[model samples]
Target: MALPRVSALRASVRAQLSAQCYHRTFHGSSARTGRNRASVLVAGGAALVAGLIAGASRIQRAEMTGARVPTALDGKDLESRCSCFMAPPVTPLEGLRSPDMKSRMELLIMETQAEVCRALAEVDGGASFIVDRWQREEGGGGISCVLQDGKVFEKAGVNVSVVHGFLSEESIRQMKSRGKSLKTKDGKLPFSAMGVSSVIHPKNPHVPTIHFNYRYFEIEEADGNKQWWFGGGTDLTPTYLNQEDIVHFHQTLKEACDQHSPTFYPKFKKWCDDYFFIKHRGESRGVGGIFFDDLDSPSKEELFKFVQSCAKAVVPCYVPIVEKHKNDSFTPEEKLWQQLRRGRYVEFNLVYDRGTKFGLATPGSRIESILMSLPLTARWEYMYTPPANSKEGEILKVLREPKDWVH
Candidate 1:
């Protein structure tokens, strides 16, 4: 359910009360006394105050019930009956019924989140995810699911967030850097961001950690114009390199992209490589998969289908690797190496990732959801180095120079 729009409620109440007061005024004597007009003014003022109090009471009831009031402006026309979804659709169902891209994206991510979670649970054998459905006061809300200390995964978080609100000046400036000509009124422009993001940390070092996100963004100017874009990527960060596994991962991504355009895989792969680089360490976060942003090109429907393909490609891309290696034996030293790699992951997300920065800067941003990508644990050592001939050293070399995994 959505957060109740008190402003809208107030407007409705005001209109109704104002109509009644005005109707009486119209039907009254044509030559009314000044005293009568003053009385009428006082009555109007009292009506407004009463309307405000009534709106406040409704909002309070909603909060107390942990639900929202179904107003004519909201839930009435919408129809949502999908029980398999992780939560109630963030966008109104009526809006989703149309050819609206926002609603489509919301549905896509919700379905993706459910599918991903169910697949992971199947692999975990018994460990189930804990789901939290939360609403942001500003506009929308999200469903967050986590499975910690599972049989196969150490920690995994699959989250779907749908939020709409005003963008801060800094956020607009960042968007402007992407070549978006954004104009705001009163230093704030309405915007919406919706996405499905997941990070899977397998208990086994050989299994690797996987992260992927697919999102749609819309920013509206004061003149009632809006700009929409789609952005997302799927990437792998392995503690140790498995050539066959990496090949399969990239191949799946390539297949997804290939279905859209030949240029997609190559262009987005390079973008992924560049975006995930750790400048200070002179290494990429992991062997790159594919990353692209500000993708308002080609066509909206085409791009949406492309993102859908990529999102659906996730299960086939990753689950096989986990199934094959979940029980692979490893030494304590190798586990420590995995921890070290996780520390690097933490570094990339916290210090360099734009998503993390924006999430932190946004109002009402969920801290746990924002930082959910971090592994359950990590180790940062001073000037740590593996033996040149070791597998750990080989992995570092791979990170330093990303190979054409699919090729």
Candidate 2:
């Protein structure tokens, strides 16, 4: 059984309650005294709140009882489903592979993917590409790229996404209570869709892992479809925070955000802080960059333009950063510490991530790729303590309480 999208669930429940209240008040209106109208209105409003609370409680109970909520598909199932989609056309990965490829940005994506892949391959041995695509059981589909074993990065791949689908607002709300919410909407779940990319773990401590994604979504209404937006950003994580590397990473990302809007850097930086938070630890995964989810008000075309801007910035933001550290040597001790930190990363994914749950629920998903974010090694020392005020402890402090980098 899988959980519902929390925001949609909440919105659905709220909408239902609102409808019930409106119906009761209008129906119960008195012809004689205007006072009766007010009375009914008050009662109806109270009933709406009561109904929402009751509905939420019921859903929670059903889920706790493991009342089988049909899952779309898990990771392994998704892989097989996606492979079937690709069997017919043996299009080489080098060309335009996405459906909406007529745009100039799409052309650039082709060149970027090729050039980036070439650069990455040269840095380390060529990455074994794990590419797959599938129609989402929810509404749309997307493609994922995963590269393992590299000279600069231990493992890294940028997952590009394209999707469109519907999730009830009530479902989204329930998902949040369960800590699975991402950048989704409030009110009734809009007829929504998105494209995204996210990278998991990197091998070298010096290489610093990174994650970036950009997507667009829209909401539909009874009168007319309304509201569309673009969202996503890049962030950097290092086992050791080299001041220069941190500066370079943020500066590059700031340039990207600034190019779109001056307000973007601060707004998205805060969003990243909030979005990438490891809720269990009450801290962020690393020094923040720009991260935003549901960005609406902008026209779809405008959103796409912003998406292209962000996407184009990715290679510049990260490849150079990787180039700087790919050759840095590390001792076995440093490698071991890197693995230890990976345990925290795993905890965030398994225990709190929406992606993990979604993948587990989706049929025919690929477990290995879903879990590829996991480090090659990990450690958990029983009741271990680090020396106070040491560099090791400095990193630990930031992990304990996330820092605001741009601020």
Candidate 3:
């Protein structure tokens, strides 16, 4: 290679890198200040841009001078930074070489899982998560963290999984039915899915139960092209209706979504209500939060940033409710109602949840992790019903008719 061409190569690298990095910035701002939050975002963006430019310049100079160099953004450096992860990443360093969205998504979920567990433990005070790392015989693995019977929380499970294998014929048919343009040579497609999923059921019926999952999925098409998309959502399931707490949850989620696109919140909120419905009972699983799937629109980078906003919104959305109500006194009847509501949660997950059914049907899937979302306690009396004009009846009415909580 001639020395003159080095300048051209450096320019090309800079252009490519800028294309990928420039679109990224902090996703959301505090809704209170009419978003002077933009100023903070711009400052952060400026810092990131400067750092990226300096690193590229350093690497270019090093190449020309034949000098050794290392960077914090390199995969090796990043692996060290992510040392706090519950388990080693699914993809080896070599396999994760260059244009590294796959590895970045993996790290994001790991970070989310860690953060959620820490926040819950801090609030619980007397309990910490028990981390369980396990591997799938066919492909990848996961870490499941559980904190059970805590002072505040009853049962909490926060899990991160990275798995890759061939999708079965039944799965293929299911995807195709959803309007996915997919084909299988021998009725199988090479696929990978990674995500952070959590279910937090508090001891007091006053503190609502929260559930969320954020995931990225990819499939290797028969033509050697890769097809990828993002999915997952967060929702609230309260034994007793508290309008203020529910409003706070919805508002936080709306703020996050609005930062991405004005349309995202409303569209996904409706999707959440519709998706979580227990068809047999003709009522929603919960008061709805944002739910979206098969999202491969606008651009990959933009969508990734949007997902990050939603993931970060989880803590702000649910933790305040926990702190406020953790010590609130409850009657035995209230506890009984909570258990009965949990029975509905179990029914929805077992019979209606696509994720649960998919995990159950998949070969070599970890059953314990799939079922970890179940609460420690649930009850179903034979055709039991809440009394007329009772508080429980009010909850049933709201569940049957979802509300626009944010507005």
lDDT of 1 at 174: 78
CA shift of 54, model 2, Å: 61
TM-score of each: 0.80, 0.63, 0.81
1-407: candidate 2 lDDT, tens digit per residue: 12233334334433432232111112242233421112121121111112212222111111111122222334332222222121111122322234342222233333234334434544555444444443445544444444555444566554433344455544455445655434544444444444445564667776677776555545555446455555567777778867666666666667656655788778887777776778776667777778876555455545555656566555555655566666678888788777767776777768865565655554434465467566666787666566767656777777666665544
Q: Considering only N, C-alpha and C atoms within 3 Å, which residue pairs clash in candidate 1?
A: none
Which 10 successive residues of model 2 have the least lDDT summed? 57-66
- Stretches off by above 4 angstroms in model 1 are 1-81
CA lDDT, every prediction? 0.74, 0.50, 0.74
* Residue 55, candidate 3: C-alpha displacement in angstroms: 23
Error of 1 at 355 (Å): 1.0
Q: Which ten residues in a row have the lowest lDDT in candidate 3?
A: 57-66
lDDT of 3 by residue, 291-315 (tens): 9999999987778778877887787
Give lDDT tens digits, candidate 1, residues 1-407: 12123334334423432232111111111232431111111111111112112112111111111122222323322322223344456665556665477876786787677667766877888765666566788888887777888899999888999999998777778788878898789899999999999999998888889999999999889898989999999999999988888888888788778877999999999999999999989999999899999899899878988888788778777877787888789999989999999999999999999888888878888898999999999999999999988999998899888788776
